[model samples]
Target: YYNAIMACGLDSQDALEIFRLCIYDKQFIDTATLKDSQMQLKGRAASGVVFVANAALSVASITGDMSVVSEVITDLSSIGAKMNSESIRHIVRALGNIGDCEMILALLICLRGQDFANDLM
Candidate 1:
């Protein structure tokens, strides 16, 4: 399911939105699904990481639990995913969706070091 969702191109955002609505209840999240998503995103590029993170953030938004989101971040960090400008945008939006102000601020700070503050302006 996670792979299929990630494979979606132009419809990815819409699919994720619908998935978020369907899984608004925490019961919809299970150990198997979480592992499946993790496996699908493991060793992927930064865009794939962002894709999976966006989905994870949607789940976090619904359940108000950061466990999955944290795991995704940890996996990405360990692998040092090659993030590009677009990847940063997706991650920021995901963090914002889940109201992760601390992470968002941290990301902004990192971007500032990369001289993207002007772009934000």
Candidate 2:
């Protein structure tokens, strides 16, 4: 996604808005309070590039097809430290829909670097 964004020679911010409009043109998430999302993920480029993580997570959760994004999810988790707290939170919440213990173990591996406190989690 970021690659495409860069390839278009866009100024990042404007291009994101334009891209969102092109994709979610008919659908709106509403301007009301973002109770479930963090504002930081709006523009924060995790992995020093882009965190299209939200799009990947949403597709998996909404479609109830974990396989749709399992690899991407794992990649995101593997580089969890490079991501913001909100991005990781998004991944966890999305995976929560699956309620799988294997995912817990996978997340634990990533969370280990985040905190020994998380060892209790």
Candidate 3:
């Protein structure tokens, strides 16, 4: 749930505060909570594609969970999300935050079909 909130592009400080609160009460935390967050975020129809892509990268940075990040990326691709050079820059920064070489490599592979390679170069 905390991860998903951060993935919604909330400010880092706000997300951290919510994370602490959620951790303080473990009784209501469950897998369904995570699913709910994802559903809610995905249901947002007005957000830009770049925002959603960055949110996915933020999720990767916060949780270090590849599965959730992969799901977000896959969903974005499936929806044909429009990402520009700026979005790539933001994702690179988030990847730096993750500091996982394997994840970076995986992202590279996952993005091979996208048009941002030139932007990355």
Candidate 4:
């Protein structure tokens, strides 16, 4: 599913479906499943991450609810140390894309007092 998104030029809609499936489906059993799809996003060269990030934003845009977006950001922020740089960047970018004022503030608060500078900034 992730690979398919990349093959399609990082199709946001497809990526969103993958994100929804990961969240709603109990059948998906993998370490990556727990992480936001954005966290696993790769660049255009890598492709996978690009689609996943686009998908997340598309989902947020369509729903107008921050549930999925917040989950991804919170999960990513909480587990920032465990993720790679690219993953963390994607997670942050996802948050930024959502453009939710409340969520952005909350994330900022959570980031406070943390030693890691890159994830929050």
lDDT of each: 0.50, 0.44, 0.50, 0.46
Q: After superposing candidate 3 on the true structure, give the runs of residues whose Cα lies further than 4 Å from its correct spot.
A: 1-47, 82-99, 102-115
Between which residue pairs do clashes occur in model 4?
A: 41-49, 42-49
lDDT of 4 by residue, 1-121 (tens): 5544345443444545565554443444333454534454423332333234444544454434345545544543443323333443454555676565676567557667654434335
- Cα shift from native, residue 77, model 2 (Å): 9.7
At residue 32, candidate 2 shows an lDDT of 16
Model 4 alpha-carbon drift over 4 Å, by segment: 8-10, 30-87, 91-110, 115-121
Could you say which candidate leads in TM-score?
A: 3
In the range 13-114, model 3's lDDT, one tens digit per residue, is 444344434433445434434544465332223133434345554645554544444555555565445545544554555666668667667767777766
Cα shift from native, residue 40, model 4 (Å): 15
Expressed as tens digits, the lDDT of each residue in 40-59 for candidate 2 is 33324333222444444444
Clashes of each: 0, 0, 0, 2
Instruction: Note each model's CA RMSD in angstroms.
Output: 10.3, 12.0, 9.9, 7.3
How far off is model 2, as Cα RMSD?
Answer: 12.0
Error of 2 at 66 (Å): 2.2
